[model samples]
Target chain A: MLENKDLLGIKNLSPFEILSIIHTAEKMKLRINNKKLRENTLENYNMVTLFYENSTRTKMSFTMAGKYTGARVTDLGVATSSVNKGESLVDTGVTLDQMGFDIMVIRHSMTGTANLLARNVNASVINAGDGINEHPTQALLDLFTIYEKKKNFKDLKVAIIGDIAHSRVARSNIFGLKKLGAEVVVCGPATLIDKNIECLGAKVTTDLKEALKDADVVMGLRIQLERQKGGLFPDLREYSQIFGVNKDLMKYAKEDAILLHPGPVNRGVELSTDIIDGEQSLINEQVKNGVAVRMAIIDLLIERRKKDEVTNTKWSASESFIQDRWEKRYTG
Target chain B: MAAAKGGFTTICCMPNTNPVVDNEILVEYIKMKAEREAVVNVLPIGSITKGQKGEELSNIGLMAQAGICAISEDGKSVENAGLLKKAMKYASMFNLPVFSHCEDMSLVGGGVMNAGEMAQRIGMKGISADSEEVIVARDIILARSTGVKLHICHISTEGSVQLIREAKLRGEKVTAEVCPHHFSLTDEAVEGYDANTKMNPPLRAKKDVESIKKALKDNIIEIIATDHAPHHIDEKNCEYDKAAFGIVGLETALALGITHLVEEDIISPLELIEKMSTNPAKLLGIDKGSLEVGKVADITIVDPNEEYLIDANSFVSKSKNTPFNGHKVKGKVKYTIVAGKIVVDNGELMD
Candidate 1:
């Protein structure tokens, strides 16, 4: 059972919790394929998607996951919503909570937006993605996909390449992979990499070849071309040539090394066109697993909330019974 | 009442309030209000630019005559350099020190915390040290050229300290103040995503904290001021990037200094007093910060051995947006006398 009611980040999750989430996701993946086997795990549960930032894949993934589990999912369209009329994130969360929302999956442009909402509301908060912070579900799905290919996580060399500084995907993967006993190496240009990322228990390197050496899993992070305006790099062509994953770079890893990317992939930038469509690529599998992983996370959090409610009710009932006996005894 | 409860006999108010204090009328208005209603002395620092918009200079000469002790563009740097130079020249003519809030707006680029490992780890944009150091360098140069008494506010990074130290060595009329939060905390404090830890120039790295302590001890940084900005709970209880920058410092300032600097052997108690009280008074050209004969009895009596936790809820200030809540520290204020009248007694404000 998951100890936390909210899935904020992989950094806070234990090894047991990580394995449990992955195992539950495995069962969910089977249920996703077989319609007859689908259980109404989250029946009548009210889940809302509160995305402050624009997204198609992640938003749709969570929506579908909720629907499959028989939970009613509502997308709070931020652009058309009262957020423009100056309603704060807390206000929106509290209003939803008052309306009896069971879960809130939030993605915002600011770092720690989910944590902020989780602190204020009673609803179980799932961090879809926050600015520069962890995308816990994305990492979970990636882990699920990797586990499908590799039997166990132990001693698996995972080399993650490209914009590690701004990639929440890379940050979440590093945290999750390390807990599963995987040797994680983060490779990027000096400007695109953060200072002292080794503090997060990853081997930080600028050399792509060095990072990929004998790696079991090779992950590519999208190069946000908008960062070019900030002068992080000169241009995309230079970035593609140096840090971009290609057939040449793949030779550095093991023959059986599998590829992973949190998509909307920038072809020939973060990875070459060939590598993205190659047999070793698990990018398509990642999206499919995204729904299953989210379902598992939502179900687990709802289960935890139910357990808490039962415990609270039992305690309150016992206290009332004891008070009745004392009142009767004193009156008699 | 908040200033008095913080063991402050007098506090200089920043010009960044609603309706920026730019003119003689506003300066005089503040003086009148403080005299009528305030328990402690309130010295209003006038803005460097009219409306604090950084477009043109304010009524510096007129406001100085109207009893404004200093001129500042406190919340942000004056972006236009030539205009700032003119303001500095005008301020210098009136003998009012320019309290510069040094930050290059372009360099900040929507950063919420210090551009460091902690910010990167959490996926938040970082305000690089150069954002502050560049402006510190620019303002120091401007001060030297205009010969204005330049007082850098809330000096955080080590590079800024080094620049200020070198400026003082060159005998430029430059002095800097370090806030208690700067030396007491680091960017690591932002890990929990608490909006309270959010502040301007943000909490820097451990090396910067060490450098700030060293700067205080060596007299490279001459003063300690609370960039004591108070915001509504609604303003702070939001997303980290959306939250307002700054923590309430006036109440926690002395205790933090006593615990972090005095108890830790970074500086002696007398040196802490010199930094906190004497040096600030000297920079503002005030006649207080002493117990000498015939001096005004503006005294703050503190029991330096008393240990307690900082409870923001117990604060006399209406806003409890302080990051130092439950922070254990020594030193409790026993009495605060403004012109020999008891204002704060036993750490509580009196009528």
Candidate 2:
């Protein structure tokens, strides 16, 4: 069982916890297709999706995951809410917590937003994404997809190419893969990569060929075009020719090597159209696994919450009973 | 006043407040108010720019005559070089020191903490060391050209230390101050995303902390002033990016210095006192640092051997925003006497 009340990042989870989450996700994936088995797993649970940044895949996945488990899910659209009128993140979180939200799935543009919210409220926070910080659920799904195919993480060479600095997916993946005993290498443009990323235990390289050489799993991060305005790269053409994952780059990897991209792929920017839709591409599978992983996370957290409540009730009952005996003895 | 409870007999108030204290009327008002109600001496430092808008100069000449100790464009640097040079020249003529808050706003970008491995790991924008160094270099050059008494406030980066050291070596009328946070904490403290750990010139790397200690030891950086900014709990208890900059430093400043500096043997207790008291008074040209015969009795009595954990809740300041909560520290303030009056008696404030 997960020991922490919140799933803020993969960095805080141990190797044992990583495998436990993945194993639980495997069971969830099997039950997800069978409506009868999936229904009522999380009955009476209320989940809220609070996204500060625009998202389609992550938001939809969490919503679907909650619905499949028979939990009431509400999408708190940031644009239409009081947040638009300048309600602070804490105020918004506390309001939702007061409304009896059991879990809050949050994505924000600032790093550590989920951690901040988790500290402020009683609800379990599941980080969808936070600025350049980890997107725990996204990485969990990617791990689920990889584990399904490879059946093991030991000795796997995972090459994550493109925008390693701004991509929270890459940060979460590097942290998760390293704990699973995989050799992770992050490749991107010099300006697109951060100087201190190697401290996370990932080998950083500018050479795409060096990163892709005999890789078991190859992941491509979406390069935000706005980064060009900041002069992180010159243009898409240069980025595509040098760093874009295409058929030519795939030749450097093993014949059966799989590919992954945290979707809405900027086709032709981070990955070529052929590679994104290729036989080895698990991009679509990643989306399916996202729902399963989220279900597993929500279910496990609710289970823990239930156990904690029972333990608290028992402890309080025994304390009151002892106090009653002391009071009677003194009075008599 | 909370300053009295913090063991400070005198504190130079920064001008970056509501309405921006720039004119003679405000300076006289502060002086009159302190005289009537304050238990501690309050010296008001007027702003370099009129509104701290950095567009034009304030009433430097008139404010100085009205008993202003210095002029500062603290909380930010005067972005305009020519305007700052002109301001520095006027300050020099008035015999008033320019306490510069060195920071290049353009270089800060959107950074909230020191730009390094820790910031990168957490995925927050970083404030590069050059953001501070470039301004430190610029101010030093301006001070040398204008011949004004330049006291750099809260020197954080190693590069800034090197710049100040070089300036002092050349005998430029340049001096600097380092806050307790700069010497004691590093960027690693920001890893937890606590807003209390967040402050301007954000806690730098370990090497910068080492350089700051060495600077104090060698008298390169001669003063220790608390950039004591207090804010409401609502302003601090939020997301790190949206939270306000600065922590309550007045209460914790002395204990942190004694524990981090004196106890570590980086500098002697006497040297710490000189940095905290003697040097700051000398920089401001005040007659109050030492307890000589016939001198005013502005003194802070400290039990250097007493050790205790810092509790932010126990702080007398309105805002309890401090990163050093529960931090085991050596030394405690036993008494604080200002001008022969017992203000802080046995660590408790007297009515």
Candidate 3:
């Protein structure tokens, strides 16, 4: 395994690492799309996922992603385990790591819980979502899905429109997209969008027409009502009326552009149902590529897991360059 | 041709209420509810800890969550050092000002009364003001260490106000608050053994009250929070040793502020209004404490000169025990608009 490997959410990743993960995901996507890859490329490897919160898409994507990689994926379902029995989260991470997990994909409900978990685990850590903190791979796959279709991130004007206030996805994408040289416009009502994201070099705009004009991608974020402690919103209906991306707003974007949602979309509340299902929507491709990107993450982690295996294993010239970077990262 | 009515609205409500809003959801809910039913914007305080157990962290994505623009621990102090640091580190993330109740239960040992001469005279044990002071120190240190926004709630002592004022001068995001009772009453008010006067940090001495009053005039104490705790009669009617602490303050807050802080020549009328209506909103990082357009239509209209007597039985909230019962005071919320919708109009519930 690559020693000291960690994914504390994609926000902590730089542009090059994100590009590498995306390149790997792109290759995996081509294989999966062409129906030529059924090898379970990571058959003998082991991945342990420890989920400490409720998730629909992240859990399923990580699960299928590992299965597609040919790894022996053991799901450490936390609902009935010792984690629920007053066992601190640190002990749980140590338990999974000591049990020889090649990689650890974890989603926690507490902030910094994943970083805390990373310190305890021996395996590579991938944070799914730590409360509203950050979701690294989700951001990775999102960028991957976009870059795959667009072929580049430089100079792309993407508008992330929706609950920027409660979204870790928005935060990670702001970092990943900006690092890749994309100018992002974060849009929503004043209360729904975090204005400080402008510090990350994204322009903050409340005017939908202004934000969507000439945008290469209109990425809509979900309003996280489940995480609402009381109700930060005056009303979701009112929020939808003001900030939700509708067909009218979509008319302002680039003609060949796409609608991106880190799914579980709140139809008509954040984006119109028809637009989400429209041909311009890359929402499903995001989900499909979610597994592939996760597979890429797991494979990269496991490749670092193997010490001398890659020496005898032949890799392309570009991959050898990646290997050299990994060696420098480890030695440095 | 334009229709003209020369009048404004006011609201007298505490940002620290149940479901301790320390995140966007609670803030938006207040705004939504206020906009739909109330007449002005309803600014709420996000709880310092996610659910007020003071353990988990709340979402600091930003303070843009409608009604909740600020955070507070309500009646509890942050006990965990690491958690307090974490709370401070994420201070800039949500960009919220945090208010603390300023009592270290560990040091205070849950002493029901203030540690003072009155508690000794009544032969009932009291908590040392140091118990509250120590936590203030700890919180200040935490703020200095992590650069998080910090405000002391109910600065009932001279030491605490001095500390806050000094911290402010030193460029810390430090601010403070005093209650209507802290300057209006002393532990002597507890002489009748009234359980309603009993509170967590407890009431303090005359010198402390004077300090708070001076702090108010000096602008060291920026807001006059009501503490606005509501509890059923059964919870506060028993013996001092058995009854629960905390007296409901919602309806009485603005009146008490007008009576003690404004009418007594201690503070100016506009300054009192700013303290009650504006500075608290500022402390909590919201737009409610003002009259700015493109702003959430939250406006509170009040009769600052109106005279009224406090009655425990007729409060908007469902609690009756109050220390201010029978006290005469000026200032009343003529109307409370959450967002152009009137929740309370002419002392009537519009919803």
| Best model number under TM-score | 2
- Score candidate 1 by DockQ: 0.42
Give the range where candidate 3 chain B is weakest over 10 consecutive residues by summed lDDT: B1-10
Q: State the lDDT of candidate 3 residue by residue for A228-260, as single tens digits.
A: 433556777777888788887798999988889
Question: Each model's DockQ?
Answer: 0.42, 0.42, 0.00
TM-score of 2: 0.94
Clashes of each: 1, 0, 48
- Go through the candidates in order and give each one's C-alpha lDDT: 0.89, 0.89, 0.72
**Clash-forming residue pairs, model 2:** none
iRMSD (1 decimal) for each model: 10.7, 10.1, 26.9
Sort order, TM-score high to low:
2, 1, 3
TM-score of chain B of each: 0.99, 0.99, 0.84
Candidate 1 residues B1-351, lDDT tens each?
888888988899989999999999999999999999999999999999999999988999999999999999998999999999999998888899999999998889899999888876777889999999999999999999999999999999999999999998899999999999999999998887878889997999999999999999999998988999888877777788888998888888999999999999999999999988898899989988878999999999999999998877778887777778778999998899999898887877887
Candidate 2 local lDDT, A1-332, one digit each (tens): 88777898999999888888899988888887776676676779999999899999999999999988889999999999999999999889989989999899999999988987887677888999998889999999999999999999999999999998888999999899999999999999998887788898999899999999999999998888899988779999999999998998898999989999998899888899998999999999999899999989998888877887876633222323322322332333
Indicate the residue-level lDDT of B40 in model 3: 38
Alpha carbon lDDT at A241, candidate 1: 93
lDDT: which is higher, 1 or 3? 1
